[model samples]
Target: MNYTYYGMFLWLPSVLSEKGYSLVHSLGYVLVMTLAQVPGYLTAAWLVERWGRKKTLVTAMILAAVAALLFGLANSTAMLIVCGLFLSYFMLAAFAGTYIFTVEQFPTVARATGMGWAAGFGRIGSALAPFITGWLLGVHLGYGWIFGLFFAILLVGFVIVVTLGYETRGKDIH
Candidate 1:
């Protein structure tokens, strides 16, 4: 859930306007960032099998944090786009890993129930993020602040995944 808000809210064009990017360029960059997630998802699919769920998730979380931090502190448009691309990559990868791990946490009997609740509750974060971000942006908090908050939230997700996440790799799902 920690990441759900970020995934839903960090529409790069909207957020990058504060990064000193024009709407057109920001939109282009954001489009690239969004497209970049495909590789991350494919990577996660591979890593979840090769490296196992926990490692894949942890790696993605750390990378996501770094990317978000860089995006927040970036001064150049080039840097901003670079960081945003990586941020989306890792964030989506982490989300994919966590989602699979969550589904694997339960037996077949309860897998549907578990997924339902996880998805249901996860939407709360998604629903709330725009509002929170709107308020933050409206207050003239700056792009740094917006991205900084996302960085912090990503850390929270990292902690949660590292501390509480169980390895489901190689375990039978049936």
Candidate 2:
């Protein structure tokens, strides 16, 4: 999720320019997409309380993956904007839920260490994303391929969550 989100957003403007959009338009689109993050995080906060952490993260991952795929396939400007907006929204929401969920899993004594480590490991993905995305583009893989890769990764995350993740919702922390 971090890889996909950071990779796509980091390279989005360049991708748009390569797709023939003017730099100004590309930046404008990116701005609009980035602005969606605020509400996405807010929504995650609400869903974490209402739907629980696991469900919120899983749902956000799935939706973000779909939105990314759709954004890649989009031919019209409107579709691009709409799909981009959704992709940004759900990705950030997933991150928000992840922060809340991960913290809840640790006992107080280890909470800081656990949170720091988890976040640090996640940043590894973020750090690698730009390089990989650049390589993908350099190799001439199309947008569909790029976003399809993200879709696959997100599904893997969903599976990991389903298989290994236990609900932390309403549980008493040690």
Candidate 3:
């Protein structure tokens, strides 16, 4: 989770530069994205309990993919900002739910270990994102392609969660 946001920090400046935006404007994009995290976290907490965790996670992943696609296709700064907010909301929500879901999927004895391994794997991807983004940008590929890639990743996640993840709508964890 931390690495995901951190990856964005590495790419924001370069992405803004590609769009010919000022540092202030670039920072605004980051700020908007960050601010969306608050509601996202809250929404995840509320909805995970109300809806099933699997359903919430799949929904969030789908929404994130949509937002990423929209941001990729955005022609104006305002559109990008709007998409950023949507992306942040879905990303944070899906991340929070994944943490809870993964822990719940394990027995009491192995829950911590399971969560730790899953989180570690997520961090690896996060760590690689900056290098990947930098390389893509170096090739002069547009932001559209970059975001499109993320959208594809999210889509795959959504499919996996829906098809393979167990439903824990009311499972008790001690």
Candidates in order have lDDT scores of 0.79, 0.91, 0.80
Model 2, CA-based lDDT: 0.91
Clashing pairs in 1: none
Q: What is the lDDT of residue 160 in candidate 2?
A: 89
Q: In terms of lDDT, which candidate is stronger, 2 or 3?
A: 2
Give the clashing pairs for model 2. Answer: none
lDDT of 3 by residue, 56-174 (tens): 88898899888887887889988988888988898899887887777888789988898899889888888888887778778977778877888887887788878878987777665
Q: TM-scores of all models?
A: 0.90, 0.95, 0.91
- In candidate 2, which residue ranges exceed 4 Å CA deviation? none
> Residue 62 of model 1: what lDDT?
84
**Candidate 2's error at 106, in angstroms?**
2.6
| Higher-ranked by TM-score: 1 or 2 | 2
Question: Residue 105 of candidate 3: its Cα lDDT?
Answer: 80
The C-alpha RMSD of each candidate to the native structure, in angstroms, is 1.9, 1.1, 1.9
Better of 1 and 2 by lDDT: 2
lDDT tens readout by residue for model 2, 85-168: 999999999999998988877889999999999889789989999999999999998999999988988889888887877788
